[model samples]
Target: MLEKKSEFTIYPITVLQDNIVWVWVHNCNAVVVDPSISEPVEKWLLEKNLSLKAILQTHHHDDHIGGTQKLIKRWPQAKVVASKKELKRIPFQTFSVGDNDVFHLMDSEIKVIEVNGHTNNHIAFYISKEATKYNILFPGDTLFSGGCGRLLEGTPTQMFESLCKLNSLPKSTKIYPAHEYTENNLKWALTLEPTNLSIIERLKLIQNKLQKGMTSLPSTLSEERKTNLFLRAENIDKFTMLRRHKDSWKC
Candidate 1:
């Protein structure tokens, strides 16, 4: 996940509970994803003298879009991008997008992927540039490092299909999930597969990061394929069972 100085750098700003606000930086402009709060993000941008180019909303969850309005108040020109189908829920969206819609921003192309499961219209943003070595996926509360989002508003079949859609992406893609849930997800996975060495090693490495006060994310699809139980689920039935088990799991 190390990068040579490039035109873009997307990283996380950890916030309430486990929510992560992903800020994509390109030159002097910044695009924020799912800002759970505005004060810290606004302060950070102002300190760095970066203009808010846009705000990408993945869903209507309060924790996800809670800061959009407030953020726009400071940078009125910053576009609010969200699901076109959820206009009532996300009324402030300046640019509406749907599944598979491709848009250009900050000199890079972004693909809007409808990953509806955590919520009916939940979406993930993917960015792939010829100038960068790795692609980026900002899966808002949909695909976590070691798990998938809870099916709060969609069926298990819906969530399974969504995960499959994501799994088909190139393995080198870097996933910036909306929460620091890797440690907990891996811990639960270990309970199901006690001898899984991949899970064991990842849990250890992630624990080290947590201990040092770092976010254990920006995981590659390659790493998830090796250790993420949900991603490895062979069928919808298997995925559903794992989802149920994870829902009751305490970690």
Candidate 2:
């Protein structure tokens, strides 16, 4: 039997109310995703002796980019990657990428996926064929474990299409979203899909994880297929209805 080699290690640092700062480390160099604050991320990297190689911004939201400037100041050579279309919003971006553009970092290939529902220029990073894994999606706020991001700037149609694109990925793909909204999302989902055993079971498991103070994120595409109402949506109309219902739903 061949030993499995770890391609990357992801660190989830909870910041603010629900924002999660994801740090992807490979060979002592790190790439941060949607860092809401700088101090903790800076301290974490320093303690691990890992160099900050780049910052991947999915949107221009303040919580996502507030730490970029400070992190760049600590590691001036670190690349700040963001959507080229949002130059005015994310002006500090050193590497302005567009839809479908492929870039290399930390011995892995990253493909930029434009998902404009949460924000007009929101983008997701997809890493396929990393070490032995088939896929990994850093979907910012576009897609969550059991729910999706609010339609802040884009329309339901845009969000629907963006989610369709994500659902097309391999089932084994691991998702690393920007926030820790799984427990709440799943709770709301269960109310909507009362008869869905998959949703019920998943919610119970996630609730247990939360009680134990463990993260219930980085959910697999397969898991979402069974329990995520957004991913299971069959048509745009269905997606729009679900989005509306969730938007009005409290708790």
Candidate 3:
């Protein structure tokens, strides 16, 4: 028997206010997730001498799909993968997918998970059983580091169910959420759970990372399970209450 090899490299390109455009590189090909702009991603890919293979869109938000047109013009053959239901919103999609759809990309299997919370047709990509050190999840705006997405289009119950779907994944999954809201979210959590040691310790570590101009995302499932109030909610009602409170709570 031979040992499998890990060949993928995920790069986090922080763009806009809090959005993070994730670039997954394999060999000489690369795939970008939720590009808020084109110049930075185009420049980065050009500098690395990597050709764009695809652009994976998790939702139809302007921030998530803003750079797709420009990026595709630079690499005409590069596939634009987005939600099939978002055709009107994301018109550049060459490969439109739906819930439970599985596709191979960069030598890894990508599973589409429909999570309706921030949006009605939002989806999260999951790559499990990889030879890499950990599994990967590009959860978009659904699940954040210390919190989840705001209930914009979907209801509290919908968001809660969506979170439950994500929480069902393995604890080793490395979450690559779209935004850099971990620090702020954790701060909010601390206010609600001041006595919780896990929240306190996580906040301290996140503060240190911020001080060094670092991102505190890509949180593990285990870490989120322990500290994320949304994920820890026992039922839909509890999740609803927490969401409502967080929505109005100030930092």
Candidate 4:
């Protein structure tokens, strides 16, 4: 099995101004995460000769699931995996999952983590194989490179707890968030702690990546620990304050 041999890489497709559609591939099969649109993704997959195996929906938001039905039309065999709790919104879900449910995809173990702050029943997929060097987290709109999603449907406490769960993953875990917001997020963090070298250095690096038209994401948990203010918050009160501040922050 590919799980035993361990071969996979996640490719990012930038779309819809800021949304990033991650495609995890192994042995000519691909699994898409929150495709904001279909044409670009379809062209990329076809060019690579990859077969669509599944689509993982993290939330019911239009930007997240808008391209799903079209992709399904292109590949009727592709499975649409989503939260069972959001059946009404994500009615096309073929594999309805819940928090902590483990499933196999492309020979890797994929665990569903309910991260409800971005939206009620929003989930993240944590993928790992025994021989894999690093675990990969598709955190949809929950945990970003240097920040977290807004409290759209849940409270600060729930968002805090959700982040804690993600933070508990291996330090080597590679975080693949759904947007290219690292530069702005880090810039915002720097405003709070201008003397913090970690934030300053990272912001510079992220800025360079942006200038080069490169993605500064798939950030490791280790990096986030040093640079992401939301990940560094020690308590719920602090998390709440940070959330409120970030919401009103300009950059």
Candidate 5:
């Protein structure tokens, strides 16, 4: 039912609990990112009559790549793009890529960024096109709206470095993280910095959007710099401290 008139556009399909499967569409072709399941995505693509061009897997987590095999069954020719370092973990990847690797798809340039934190070999996709107004980042679970992913397979140092790399992107870059954790993240930030006007204001706006059943994502990098505490950390110690606090945080 979604319109397909745009030269390029990204749509979010909220699946499972808070996971968001981002579908990037250009003309009649579609590329799904971190599809948690195949039913809804299959239904949506079938309804729009869009051809599945590929599926971008950020990591090997079940919630991220669970539906990939099923989707590939539906679209036999659709390529599975994933980190080359994760071949053992993500065996379905047909187009294996590594850090700094660049490729063209859907008339846009995609740069692979190896951001290991939530999981070793986790990677993010950065999309840029001369025709688009702004760039896009499909950061999977490594970066969120108001927080960063917990250090699971990698160390604090790795996560800190990963966030710095993302922060270096153009401020206008729109972030499409793989989960709908904006509201909860902002609330947690507010608890830490109660007087932060940026956090308070963004929380109100995000709450309103969620109340209306709208996603509070695809947030610009500039907005994240203003409110994401993890991004504001100046050093590894600070970043580590914030991560520990967030892990133990109840709210």
Candidate 6:
């Protein structure tokens, strides 16, 4: 579904296979999250006549930060918000934040959540309910619609803990992940629980959305609690087993 433009709206720009560049718009200003490339994002902003406000970098991954430098070049005054620990990797950050650090942006309070799993020092941005109708989470690569990020540089235990941190958020929170992997992740979940009606129904709904060229994202925490296996995992052992299975399993 297309997000309605109100006082503030977040829109998705699909690029580079599954990468999603999320743009948060308020008035004539915009904040982009994890831009994989510059051309399309720049064109979109220019066409909309929106002035770039800042860029939220969830991690230092090349795909996430690749377009940042160019975007900042176009909007020279725009701030680059990223983890303080990733200074070496993401040298462009003008606003460095640490875990639990609260900061204000676009008239809303943003809480930094350090969720190291996809990579060490990986972080997620959490906007409290005071910011919007519902709380918002920009999980970058740490969390997806139906799955958690791969254990690229962090341990399975760390990944499990990271997901737990995300899970602790209010059920009404809307999750905006960096990639469009809901359908594939749900399909993988079905293999483990073929009789699970929640996963079954969610997969069908996500498939319909994808068929219509709509992104199956911005999923609510409540919806994920019911369908996402990683979030449902009770312990590190279960999470590790599922993560390993998913890594080796093919569609």
C-alpha TM-score for every candidate = 0.97, 0.96, 0.96, 0.97, 0.98, 0.97
For each candidate in the order shown, give its overall lDDT on alpha carbons.
Answer: 0.91, 0.91, 0.90, 0.92, 0.93, 0.92
Ten contiguous residues minimizing lDDT sum, candidate 4? 1-10
Model 2 Cα displacement at 113 (Å)?
0.5
Error of 2 at 84 (Å): 0.3
Worst 10 residues of 6 by lDDT: 1-10
| Residue pairs clashing, model 5 | none
Strongest candidate by lDDT:
5
Using TM-score, give the best candidate's number.
Answer: 5
Q: List the residue pairs that clash in candidate 3.
A: none
- Model 5, 1-251: lDDT tens per residue? 55666678899999998999999988889999998899999999999999999999999999999999999999999999999998999998999999999999988899999999889999999998777666999999999999889887999999999999999999999999999899989998988899999999999999999999999998999999999999999999999999999999987
Evaluate model 6: give its TM-score. 0.97
lDDT of 4 by residue, 40-92 (tens): 99999998888999999999999999999999999999999999999999999
Counted clashes in each candidate structure: 0, 0, 0, 0, 0, 0
Candidate 2's displacement at residue 36, Å, is 0.7
Better of 5 and 6 by lDDT: 5
Pairs that clash in candidate 1: none
Per residue, candidate 2 scores C-alpha lDDT tens digits across 8-44 of 7787898899888998888778999988889999998
True-vs-predicted CA distance for residue 89, candidate 3, Å:
1.1
Better of 3 and 6 by lDDT: 6
- Candidate 4's displacement at residue 34, Å, is 0.3
